[model samples]
Target chain A: MNWKEFFKNLKTEEQGCVPDETRREFLKIGLIITGVAAGGSLLNVVSVVAEGLATSEELSKEYPYKPHYSMVFRVDRCIDCERCVEACRQTNNVPEYGWRTKILERVDTKAVDQQRQFMPILCNHCNNPPCVRACPTQATYKDKQTGIVKMASYKCIGCKSCMSACPYDARYFNEEKRAIDKCDFCWESRLSKGMKNTACAEACPAGVRIFGDLSDPNSEVYKIVHQMGKAVWVLKPETGAKPNVFYTIG
Target chain B: MKRIIILASTLILGLSGFVLSEITEEGVKYQESEEAGGLEIIYTKPVKGVLFSHKLHVKELGLPCESCHTAIFEMEAFKSQRNPDFIMDSLYKGKYCGACHNGQTAFASNTKCATCHVGVKGLERLKKKAQVLEKK
Candidate 1:
């Protein structure tokens, strides 16, 4: 409570209780236990690339959703064609002022040859979504079966808390809906009708966007994320949202 | 008669036009003199922001105009764009830019996509640059 009472109850450091060698031995044992828990999967053991960046989960702990939906962007292949953005607009009926997905440009003058790159971004549908946590009403929620962050327009109070909470800049307020709206991986448009992929993923002529169930071993998303061949990463990983969308070069 | 002929020639030269490519950030001119080197080309069909720098191919790589012109590309800029067949599929099949970009003569069209595909941002940047130059 108060400073005086807090100081009275505070415990001082108990030094010389354990020797340095003993503490190091305990640490080594802890590492071994963690290694055993990870099942010696090289990517999991090394925690290189996607395993380390996308989530805190060990290999065994991943794919929590029943048919975990995920997306991977082969970023090098993207030319900012904006076809994916257009497809998303028509398919979802997103307002002209709003967007479900966007392409970002990074321009570097010092780089040799090509000095510009385009990056397309959308809802990461994070396993530990801050937006879901910030929603006072049950308006925004992460789906159980597919792990998509969805919005219930009727329940929204237009408080705009979830908009600020999102790390990916994914959510947008729709005036017509009178609520917040976000990318649902086309769950409402096509996936519910047994379509195989999102409108964006299907519309990309460059094969830049790969969308599939992360839990299924046969899926492309699972293969790309699991392999050590190419480095895969998520945006603002330090925020610890555990995003489903990963990015990598072709 | 000579005075009248001179005035007509000057009018033709002015009407022909030339692009004023300023010194890029790398401190290299993307085009040479107003009369010699070709202009910078940006494609906006099928996709946007695909760039073709003549200075890179001609000046840096030392390719003569005949290497692409008359045989591969016509001297006219944006003329190939009129063809409906001018797409990536055609390039992969050893047509147009693919004639040189087929991995043997140069890097393949599929590889290093951003090298030429400057993107929508690049298109906007070029437009902005032109506006800024006009204001100056």
Candidate 2:
């Protein structure tokens, strides 16, 4: 009743205005429309929608996180210059022993056409974050708002459980911080300051990393992930973490 | 006496092999030869970790030195990288590696960048190999 109106009024420009379509759709379902969730998302509102009205496609394709911070890589364009790595280090003050992001090189001499491919990887910020689940202290978690896998460093007990829990090997124990450190999609260093893109995305000369709001259909990340022309894949899909990071080729 | 002479000859042959082309632990061939096995050049400018294999171009493709040497590139290695014009944009406009890699003659430089890039990881790998070779 008044709660919906109150929230609607409270909706600042930054949090994004909820489209009338979504509001109407949620209204039709007779659900409170707190938030729309994507595949494997933590929101309870989606379960209600899935129970009656929404199709599987809508369930899977919908953006669960507001601003749905995500990254897509044009891997074919990546030269693995490590410029992104250096930028991330400088921006985040990442130690030499610890890495928030890195490039993995794959060379298959027997492969047809180009035998070398470089894959840049960071925290996937999985909707169903095992690292978050494994953290007894809740030191690492998936933010309900931005869906970024963030670290509450002070809360950490120097546990390495999240390190083993992460399927992408994205987490590392930081001796300096005495905490588990991973990519927060540059939230602390950039996005939190109203910056549009991550440090790595900005540093790439090859346009390999495209970071943006995946929830917004207009965003390049949403279009690339939804597009049919090129293959878009996430690392370790079988792990079923529902990673926000996606990979594509030129 | 015969064994000593044979060993000496083998050492000479090994030394001669270094004069033209040398192979790394990864089997990537590097050379600065007039006939074949051209030098493998790694570019740190524009960006880091771009590898150009002379074996891939001159030896594997069997292209003559005249195709690139003294025309598209100087006989010197990394000399082209010093030129401010030596970049992917210039290649796209039909300069340097772009001369033959323009999709008409060879694969476009824009496509499959990792094929040449080898990246910073590749550069470090090469450096480590150099250090190991020195130890040997």
Q: What is the DockQ of each candidate?
A: 0.55, 0.71
User: What TM-score goes with each of the models?
Assistant: 0.76, 0.77
lDDT string for model 1 (B1-136, tens) is 9999999998997797654554332211223334435767677776877778786787767888988888878986677877899899999999999999999999998888988887777777765664565455
Top of the candidates by lDDT: 1
Cα RMSD, each candidate? 10.4, 12.1
Kindly report the docking quality category of candidate 2: medium
- lDDT: worst 10-residue window of model 1 chain B: B23-32
Cα error, residue A99 of model 2, in Å, equals 0.8
The worst-scoring run of ten residues by lDDT in candidate 2 chain A lies at A29-38
Residue B14 in model 2: lDDT? 88
Task: Give TM-score values for chain A, per-prediction.
Answer: 0.78, 0.77
- Which residue pairs collide, candidate 2? B31-B39
Fill in the DockQ of model 2.
0.71
Evaluate model 1: give its lDDT. Answer: 0.75
Residue-by-residue lDDT tens digits, candidate 1, A1-250: 1223332342222123447876565444344323333333324322222444444244424556867888999998999878899899999999999989998777677988666677888998988888999899989998887888999889999998888778777888999999998899999999999998999999998999999987777788878876665666666444546678888787
Interface RMSD measured for model 1: 1.3
